[model samples]
Target: MRPDPEGLLPATEPVTLIDSDGAPVTPARAAVPPASELVAALGAMITARRFNDQAYALVRQGRLAVYPSSHGQEACQVAAARVLSDGDWLFPTYRDTAAVVARGVDPGQTLTLLSGEWHHGWDVATHRVAPLTTPLATQLPHAVGVAHAARLRGEDTVVLALCGDGGTSEGDFHEALNFAAVLRAPVVFLVQNNTFAISVPLSRQTAAPSLAHKGAGYGIPGQRVDGNDVAALLAVLGAAVDAARTGGGPQLVEAHTYRMQAHTNADDATRYRDDDEVAVWSRRDPVERLRTFLTRRGDVDEARLAAFADDAERLAARLRDELAADLRHDPSELFEHVYATPTPQLREQLAMLRDEATRDTPAGGSR
Candidate 1:
């Protein structure tokens, strides 16, 4: 594909459709998206934006201890999530809750996960979306393992692993890619380069030109795309997922995006990045870009956009209420899943703890 240098996308190079203003830019000419698809994409983008906003608010209010914001990277996530097949597995990081929601997990259930009420949120096995791994870059090897298992079982399932650019530095990243390549497992490693690992900039992450180039070392196909461009993100991920489903081994995709918000509720980005940098990224807001594109093309009118916003608000309110009513896990429940059968030492410890609790209680009181 030829690069469109005129379109100033967030990436170092541009190879996607629909610029930040929603102009339909082609290799030869610029145009617009189809009416129906454009409206749907617009609605999805709006809903996703609202979802991220509400999630951030909840984090600030202490409803959630910490949250990795997906404020600016929703396009890449939503597009990728939409491309998954039924049997495919998604290994997502902490910041990928949006993609998880798009892949069929309910936002309420996500709240449960983030709140630490559940260990395996949304039944990963049933949902085909694995539990969100907080540890950096660990899920890549797990995705490779899932792909290998599917192959052994004669199942045509692909594993799509999502991670941030900072995760690329881990030893597991290299190990997982090498193993997948050697075994020819069906997997797609989607790297969302938001240019920061918490407060650390991409300059400290790597000297490589792009994360895609890292795939060459593992002998896999490598590609880069404008992560903020919804249509282009969809097209690229669609092709990659199709290839994986059809027996293609693996591919590495570096999605160039920006983290418009802090890394998480606990982070303060201002200490590391200047206000000017944030302002630059704000101009490329994926949600606003798509909305502008849809409006300019007459694909979705203002009333329709308003309706989407209304629906998103209603959904967010419902999620807030539902999460409020869900039971918070008992602290003791933490030990429940630690073993299939308790070891002798663990059993003795539990017994001792139980006796101590009983002894400490008042004569007629139950503890």
Candidate 2:
């Protein structure tokens, strides 16, 4: 028999687990995974956290141009990825590298996307993971379109479009939500409510009390989850996925998490918020909280934790080496995908670009 759907949430309340100090707390409904799954989730979160920190260091040291740290948002990412099947599609934003990793995207390919080699890292046709979009909320429409196509073809797969809270303010967000509602498309609008968009606070983004409630305007189910709690994230995502696959249409989920680090390597959050605020959110670090929980429960040992740290360091080192050697892209490649068949206008533009390139080259210069 299928698990009782109502059991995922006993009431219309948010789910959570550990507090800032890593103490156990009663959530609306907390269902812990088995030991192996727990360890895997914990390890993945560790890997992502370590990778982001290393990337930040690299940026500061001038080895990288930009880095978006996923410090306190791992559960919001990994849990969503864990709930999806291999056939499902992921439309990720720049901040969802952890979700892409957990969704089975190769680290090398993901790094390649960020490394500037290619926009569409892998043949998403093969991996079922679309290229990460840097533009704020553009992926939402593509996700809804994919879901509509799947429904028309009678496929059981769903699409999860992960975006930030700030993305909801974009017109694409509203259009995608409205279209999905009209078509009853099987998609999950997973919004990671990190409480800030760059320097903009959530208070400035919307006057609505809850981001989840934004879905009601579009005629879909919506709920908010405590994004720091891995179990809660998983349970809520699983429920949302189940509802989607069962032809219940779309669901909007607002994951309440914090961006414990700056928005990007180029951002200085200190200008808007103080060190005390950072220190406060630092206490709610997702990785440390999970590690403490597992340790206290005797689910994972100190030796295992040490091994995880070693693995994360090794992965980060390997990624740096790989990315260092892969940082070139052809400007013409961007024009190649604008149309299935190049129109006269595109043809003229390409020809003009080639002529300029040829004219700029000195006689007998290296190609």
Candidate 3:
């Protein structure tokens, strides 16, 4: 028998396998994850959290141009990478450096976009990860198109597309869902509903009950999971990916998480949000929750957890060493990647900039 199309939705109350206090909750909506996966998730979240902290520090030290800290959302970021295979593609946004790094992209490479280097620091084709798209919801359609094309080519590939809460309101988000639903593309949309789209709260953003409910309108299944709970995210995202890989069509999984840091290092979250609210979410921190659970079950100990921290430190040291270098701008290189075929106007602007830069440079060619 066919399933009810409208019945495709997240289980009531959002799947929360592990509560904020690090205790396993009763009657979880999804299957309980194994000890191995749980430990792995804990390690990933720990590493990711440390890495995010380092990136934020880099931004402060001016080593990075900017950074969007996924401080409290490490579970969503790490689990997204954990569930997928190397053959799968991940469409990451500017805020998903932790996820990108977890997918085996070099930490230094992921920071390139934020560091104001090239469009993306690494080779997209090599890693099967797309560029860090900054524009909201633009990558949604791109991901859908790639998934559909892969289907046409008979490739066994699935695409995981991520966006923020703000992206849900975008027209591209709606269009992408419609296309994926109609085409049954092997793609999953993971919306990290981090409470706010910049300064706008979730309540002000939409009145549609929940973001996951948006999928109902497009004939796709939507599942809302506790973003801070790595176990639930892994279970739900794993199921979504498998279903899509088979013939179950696309899936939309919403992770109800929070952005512990400001939207970016450039913005001040304190101006809009009070300290109490942050404190409440801080207690629900994903990394702490997973670590607490694992430690309680004897799955992990402080020594092992410290090893993870050491690993994170090594990666951060590498990023610091790599990004700390002073880069010389070739004024001309800017116009090169802007277009495949340079526009006449761009060509004129490029020439003018080159002339100005050359004339302003020191005669000794030092400046």
Candidate 4:
């Protein structure tokens, strides 16, 4: 039976489980994961938020090249990582350091690229995580290829690709979605619609009702969930992941979240948006919303919450110490990962670079 195109489109009203007030907006529809999973998600969110804080601090101190803070969107960040299996792969954006950390990639190794140390920062095979892509939606096509290949091998491995709202505008985004739909690839596209693409707002990006609505154009099912509600995110994203893994084809999920901090350490959010708007979103903060909900339900006591905080602090301290250390990178590595088998031109360039490092290379003024 063919699915209805309109039915595949996301609802006008984003799905909401817990409201900003820590109450269920719709008790009937707010079916969350089990208690243990919710508790784990809460802990992960705490750690992720703390990780963002520490990374931003490193950026300010000039320890890193730059950092894209996932401060206010911890719900989707954590859910993206937690809803995957060990064999599944994650394709993260530059802003998804929090998601990578949640997936068990060592914090130091995860930050290696951002710290300007190495290109292949961590062995992707180690955690099945792709390199944190910074070139907009380029990773989308790569993810689709991987997921489609996995299907060909009869592997039930699912691939979750993260993208910002701005990335949806890229040509790769369209190509990937169309290819995934045609191939019936087992992939989930998680778009964190944080309202702004650096300085440009969503209004300027597209006139579509929601980012999720764009999925219908590619013949994929889509859903939109309140990104600040951890419960809602888990339910929505988990279902999407499950569907993709079971051969239900690709899924597109748009998380309506906000970026509390500047786009990156190098950006000034104050230039465009006002504080009043930020304050409005602050009331709908993911971390506080989850904490309030958990406390009210007796799922977490003061002791447990305090323990989560302590654990997060310890993790942040470790990352700080590692990032603060003096480090140097091998300059020759620039040409190493360019391709699997280098062409003659690349080989010649690699030789030239290596030879120059050994000799006193001519400066631009002399050359």
Candidate 5:
């Protein structure tokens, strides 16, 4: 059979294994992974949800400076982190704290950046995860660069870089994809199409039929998947990561999801979207769908599910207690990591800060 012309092809459908009602749309193929792995994925999603809830509560209580919740998008975060190996690197945006935690970083350390207490909460080299980037799409180019460097160094490394629908509009996003395609860099770009970027909906973000189609222009293959479906996300991301590790070059996966919470503690989502719309997506909750599937398959019983809930609660309690403690911030940390060697200006500034500290202290006592 002759293939149809490239541009005349139909739009790609979002890949899905299960329906919104928690029923399988097709048989679980051998590639679907073992039941034990799926159950662990579910556990990660539940833990992430609990962490997200506690982070938002901490923000309200003034324990955190700010938080960007990934309440409805836990599946994407968990799947992305689960697919990577220890040698692989992850480049996460400000909204990807869940992804960081899933990669085995301490939950408390993950929130340190948002709490405004430290530069990055965790060491990048030790974790193989980049610091959470607040600037839109900037991490894409960095991921590309690292992937390309690793290839030159004769190392088997894959890099997964994440961005939101709104971030796809940034110049760095385009440049990174173009470079990766040209260099055949081992990197995977995952764009979470969470319906809205802050108050701006996806409709205003671009006129393209779908975000995945953007990959075509850059000579990279793209696939769309149901972001809320943990099983589907795991299957698709696992394939993509494997392909990249095997010299498949760069690929893009756009996961369609919804942001159930306000953009942050400061913005109000009700101003732009109504309750009815949110109610619709709420029915497609990632955690509940997986739980229902597991229950039906006898992979998990009600007792086991209850135990998981208890575990999540204990995690939240620990995070809450850690955040409630009085922590000291060294003012000198500001100028410490700015440069490998301190510049004359930085030294002068450090001196000024020390002088100010001396003046603030009592003459006969230490601060």
Candidate 6:
């Protein structure tokens, strides 16, 4: 007896559009959004790259406590934000500052958590973007809850939750995926398989065929896409978001990309990885690939490209100026949101801090 040709088979490769040389290997499909829309997406990726560079600079200058640069993964960041509607929500990890900015959160405000500020920089309620989470996989549950609530309230809202390869190992990641699948929540879980969870490489992360396969256990459709290809990312992520919005239930997208920088300013990627590996990924740079494709199609000219560069530079300068400004925050703010009603121990600590501040000030002079 022979097996049926229609039998289920494993995915052989990730969805790809343009190759590293900027040549289209696949025919353009109608599912591809308009040229203008793709151009805008490219612009967002360029701007995000500039922002990531500026953040790295800020960390080096002691302005920011630390920064997880999303240099090589800007395509994932841009596509994740572009696919969401204004009424939707985005739950980002620490390295997803670019996605939050792409969602229209102010650059300075978005950097507040990295700047060692008291609270999350922007207004979550107004922007519909969650605070950049430092704890691994914690935002997954939050995203699922919001999506489930939206379904209950009969609201037309979708939630995009982002995480890295390491985050998938967290228990919260499994819990969120299972709950979302069981409840048929309107959420898209994007796992950027950047090849490392800090010093640990993906080889040791999991033995599964691919990270996308993990979603299958929870009964959610999973897809693998070339994270370095902007066109492919936009196409895959857009479809996932649309499906969730129209009651298709939750979906998982595992984008295969690389982290070109250290985990954060505090880490030393050089110790764990080789220059040869970094050099290999450098050739597949997302920004250059998109720019080349657009230019080849005559959709973008030198003058227009220069204007985009100018815009990115202006954004970086604005962020630098805002972050460089002298702004004093009250120390008392640390205790403000700790609890609706302050605990006795917290009150005592606040009093001690206030007393210390008073003693440090010159007599009869304002601090």
Tens-digit per-residue lDDT, 296-340, candidate 2: 889899899999999888878876776666355555776787888
C-alpha lDDT of all candidate models, in order = 0.80, 0.81, 0.90, 0.91, 0.90, 0.90
lDDT of 4 by residue, 138-174 (tens): 9999999999999999999999999999999999999
Residue 361 lDDT (model 2): 92
For 1-367, candidate 1 gives per-residue lDDT tens digits of 3223332122356456877776777572223334675577667777778888898888766677677889999897787677688888889898998888778788878766676565745887789998889899999999999999999898999889999999999999999999998988999899999999998888999998778878877777778888898777777777778787788788778898999898887788889999998888888888888888778877778789889999889868976876666365444565566799777787777777778877899999866
Better model by TM-score, 2 or 6? 6
C-alpha-based local distance difference test score of model 4: 0.91
TM-score of each: 0.90, 0.88, 0.94, 0.93, 0.95, 0.95
Error of 3 at 76 (Å): 0.3
lDDT of 5 by residue, 1-367 (tens): 2213363221467877766888886764415656898899988999999999999999989989999999999999999999999999999999999999999888889998888776778889998999999999999999999999999998989999999999999999999999998998999999999999899999999999899888878777788888998888999889989889998888899999999999999999989999999999999999988888878889998788788889889889988987897668677777888998889999999999999999999999989
Worst 10 residues of 6 by lDDT: 1-10
- Candidate 6, residues 14-58, lDDT tens digits: the string is 887877888786665425556797789888999999999999999
Candidate 3 lDDT by residue in tens digits, 1-367? 5458668765678999999999999876778799998987777777898889999999889888899899999999999898888889999998899999999999988998788786678889888899999989999999999999999999879999999999999999999999999998999999999998889999998998789988988888888999999999999999999999997899999999999999998998888899999999999999889889999999998898888888888988998898888877877688887889888998999999989978999898866
Top-scoring candidate (lDDT): 4
Model 4, residue 1: distance off in Å is 5.9
Each model's backbone clash number: 1, 0, 0, 0, 0, 0
Better candidate number, 3 or 4, judged by lDDT: 4
Question: Candidate 2, overall lDDT?
Answer: 0.81
Error of 6 at 331 (Å): 2.3
Better candidate by TM-score, 2 or 5:
5
**Model 5 ranges with Cα > 4 A deviation:** 1-11, 27-31
Model 6: pairs clashing at backbone N, Cα or C within 3 Å: none
